[model samples]
Target: MEYVIKGYEPADALRYFEEISAIPRGSKNEQAVAQYVYDFAKDLGLEARIDTTYWNVVVKKPASPGCEDKPAVMIQGHLDMVCEKNAGTAHDFEKDPLDLYIEDGLLKARGTTLGADNGQAVAYMMALLARNDLVHPPLECVFTSMEEIGLLGALQVDTSDLHSKYMLNVDCGPEGTVFVSCAGGLLQDISKKVRWEKAGGDTVSLQVRGLLGGHSAAMIDHEMGNSIKVMGRILHGIQKQMEVHIVSLSGGSKMNAIPRESDAVITVPAGQGDKAIEIASHIAATAKAELAASDGGLYLQCEKAGATERQMSLADSRQIIEFIFLVKNGVYTMSMEMPGLVVCSSNLGVATTDDTGVQLTDFIRSSDPTIRDHLDDEIRSLAQLLDIEIAPADPMPGWKYEAESPLRQLFMKLYKEQTGKEMVAVATHGGLECGILKDKMPDLDIIAFGPTADGAHTPDESLDLASFERTWNLILATLKALAEQ
Candidate 1:
């Protein structure tokens, strides 16, 4: 009987992709999906290894015919998705499978992110395992957990027992390009505690929203408005004309996603309350005119709310506000070789004020390891300047491309013979398993390829129905070429 499951067809990868859509596998919570892979592999009679602590699964397929002596190849892709949603979208990623639908030739989520970033690749590998007729050398397929949160699972992988000397990672964007290298990144947290004070009169909240936020490294150059920056501009504008005491400030949802909105609560003297609104209006007008093409929907509003007149001390508030203004929050430079590619960047991802202290999170990325470290140092200097505690978390290393890779040459020849066109090979500015896997298996030849996926790490994540078939055909053709060799 032909498999008609949501995401399990041998000919169409979408079949397997549909099955992934029904599973809840957001970052750090990958137990269910990990078990699914284990069960799926066992049912197919493949040798499966499951790691309980890390929730990693690996499946091995024996070599075919005369290829038994060939070196084993590893196929790797992450199992977790970045859980992000639109404001007011009410789907829980922990329990609810992503709601997937098609519109105008693009697959999209219902006001949330479609987990296609790595899900499609996972499904594709699973489908390959179910096939009985395909011929190739021995294979090892690895599914890692919590890659979105960090390369935690990959880091925890017990590589001592692995048998692969070469790997092909399927967790990258753009089908036509073969990503041979990528950038490294680091996450930093800056925090400060300030004394609270009581206000004499009325208190209100100011909010900025509707900005087009995106992946800080990928979309930073677009010049789309930033919610945190917009809020800072308004707050500074208000401070110019009147005396306002900040009660609290909060915005952003994740340490990775660009913050699309922010809110601040402050006590506005009844005398200058009207003036505060006037200044906000002026900021909004300027933003509308400036962001008319990109952040046209940007909004700034002041609303009355019931609150204690208690607020942070004046000195504390001033220092925190100044820090936000001084911090770097966008594309730092462009690649000299790859005109449009971002060589270095950073994002002031999130910030919030609480009873103890104000916590802020920033993420930085760069293709050069030295530059990534430099950026982290710059942020640490900011914390020192403001007398705040700072923490820099794990840094993911970049994949360095090999100019003399035999596998790359093989792929290039295969594509030219199959399509009569030259293949596009380049390095990406985003993180991929290629970097970590390379670190684990230094001599392992690696290359990353996938179907056409646009607007990844966002609500518009989707796979081209037509591209899936073509890409799968290419994968199969490549396998045939390798078998002949």
Candidate 2:
């Protein structure tokens, strides 16, 4: 593959960035990229292994000639990326390489995510491990898979080979702010069983589209319009004025991404399809206004559909739509400890209605354990009331900011000295693998930071080219500072 990122300061970093970007490393399909990491280390004559169960790659580069005695430091990042694209984009995540492009000094993938959320970590770590000029302690790079869905790889991977008590996590999206703590989260799949029945009516397809859906945890406070909820609201409202029976309902691709669009095919009373659509338009108008600031491009499109013999009974359809509209979603609590930080939230991420039933997926996030428990209880109660089948699950614990983190202090010191700006330590509502890794490796000191990237977990995701190289320099400087210790 030809590299579009020429002239970057560290030639190897840009080269590896372009190389890995071509591998198609969507969550759970990281085999090829994991192998690439292993082979890269093997070719360098370093210790490398891929965990058989989850395909997590771990490689060790020994300390520089003079820094052999320094403590082993692990640089960690996930190998998988959240594959998202615009609705009309023709790119396929299963096999097609990302089409990289540059605009205004920012690197982006045409109509698809750039994969820089953690891919840059891969490039940066690979460059560091491959270079002999950089001074650093023994380095362990843990490339875990399936981080985009959940921290499954980090949770399942064997870390016994790693002896590092301290780590630099390269997964944050900001440049100067170092993430010290992150919210815990629970992923749930909920279902409501149903039976189809014959309905005599005109069919119409109602689609909620053009909403700027984003990462559920990061942008929950933005109040972005969730197409699922918007469609539910339209259906719920339409039913108030006329009889409606749903044929099929579906929306969203990833359970962690707020849905940008949803489609519902339904039967309106014979000769009353026009009225139902009018009501849907009225309801959608309110939603569009409410969503103008964050998800302004919201659209509710309706069209005639071919004949369908069966549809869900109005009782089943109403229950499904009402539940979606009334579900616990968006931010629930704010942090008194950290101003402007959301402490607890949930996203109603996906919904599908088919021959068997309606299934919905949601993610609940919180930094406080008690709040997480309370929210879980609320979901359980809601599901029980509706007779919905939601399997019981445990909440993954959040990472708490430690008072004594030398790694955080080191980065802050180096960042201030290098850039003359304070590198603030912060907590986030977003979930990170650090929580799982820190929970498993109890004594592992960790801090996460990265280059400036935006619209993460969405097709609009972009990496600042200059900021990417700047952060790479910071990582190298920190490595040098640590080697001198």
Candidate 3:
């Protein structure tokens, strides 16, 4: 395959990135990518291996020529990418590779997510392991799978074999910022059963689309429109004015993405289809006005569809709508200590309804466990009222801000010396594997940084070419400094 990215230092990083991008590596489908990494390590004559359960890969390279006595260092990243694409994209996350391209100095994938979120980390690690001239300590490049799906793979890895105390997580913000902390999060799966009845009425289909959906955790504070929530409002609004029965309602592909589109099909009393459409259009107009600042492209389209035989009982439909309204979503609270920092939030990522019932995938995050629990309690109460089952997974622990981090300080000093700007330490609301790894290796000192990227977890994802190289150079320099210490 022809590479779109060129003239980048550590050219191996971009070359390996292009090669890996050609493999299908959607979350839970990372076996092939893991094998690729293992193969690359084996070819380099490095001690590389893969596991059966989670497909986590580890490649070990001995210390640089003069740094054998220095403490070993671990650089980690996830192997999976969030598989999201535009509606018309002909890509397959399980079999087809990403179509990489270059646009206006940024690297992009046509109609699909660029996968640079974690790919950069993988490529950089590969490049470093393959480079013999670079001054560095013993290298341990750990690639875990299924990180996009609740850190499943990272949670499963056995850290007992690792010898590194200083770990660099390559999954944070752009070059200058070294991430010190991140919020903890959990997924709450809500399901409710519904009874279907024969439909004998006119059909109206409503689609809410074109919203600027993104990473639910990182972009929740942006207040972008959530399609599932939008559809819920539209459904409720139609019911307020006229009797209706829901035929189907669904949207969203990933449990961690702000759904870009939502769709609903319902049946109304014969001859009342026009009224339903009119009410829906009015509600859409109001929603558009509300979303203009963040989701300017949001629009709702309503049309008549061929009649269906079965529809959900009004009781079930009402229960689902009420549950959606009761659920707490978006940025719940901001930190008082840190200005403009979102301390707590939840996202209604996906909503789907079928003949059996409706299942809603929602996630919550908070730096404070107490606040997270409080929000969970609210959702638990809603589930109880609706007599629905809400299964909450064990929460991912938050990376707490430490008063003293030698690795962080080192990076800060090196960043200041390398560039004239002060390196800022920050926390992401998005869940990083750092928290999970810290839980396993309590004493592991961790810091995270990456190249500039935009629209992560969405199809519009792009990587900043300039920041990409700057970050690579900084990481190389940081590694050299650590070896010297």
Candidates' C-alpha lDDT: 0.78, 0.87, 0.87
Any runs in candidate 3 off by more than 4 Å, and if so which? 1-49, 60-72, 78-139, 146-152, 183-185, 198-212, 234-247, 260-285, 296-311, 366-370, 392-403, 451-473, 483-485
* Winner by TM-score: 1
For model 2, how does the per-residue alpha-carbon lDDT over 1-485 read when each residue is reduced to its tens digit?
Answer: 56776664554786888899999999989999999999999999999999767989999999999999988888999999999999999998999999999999999999999999899999988998889888999999889999977788988877777888788899996899999888988878899888789867899999999998998877889989889988888988988888778899999988779999899999988888888888888889888898777788998899777789899888878778778878888899997767788888988888887679889998888877788888888887877776777877777878866678888899899999889999888988888888888877879888899999999899999999889988998999888888897
How high a TM-score does candidate 1 get?
Answer: 0.77
Q: Return the candidate ranking by lDDT, descending.
A: 2, 3, 1
Off by over 4 Å in 2: 1-47, 61-71, 79-120, 123-138, 146-152, 198-211, 234-248, 260-318, 367-370, 392-404, 426-428, 452-473, 480-485
Worst ten-residue run, lDDT, model 1? 1-10
How well is each residue in 275-369 modelled by candidate 3, as lDDT tens digits?
98998889888888988888878888899999898988888878887787667889998976566778889989988875578888988888777
> Model 1, stretches more than 4 Å misplaced?
5-48, 65-71, 79-137, 146-152, 163-165, 182-184, 200-205, 237-244, 267-289, 296-299, 302-308, 400-405, 426-428, 452-469, 480-485
Clashing pairs in 2: none
Give candidate 1's whole-model lDDT.
Answer: 0.78
Q: Name the TM-score of candidate 2.
A: 0.74
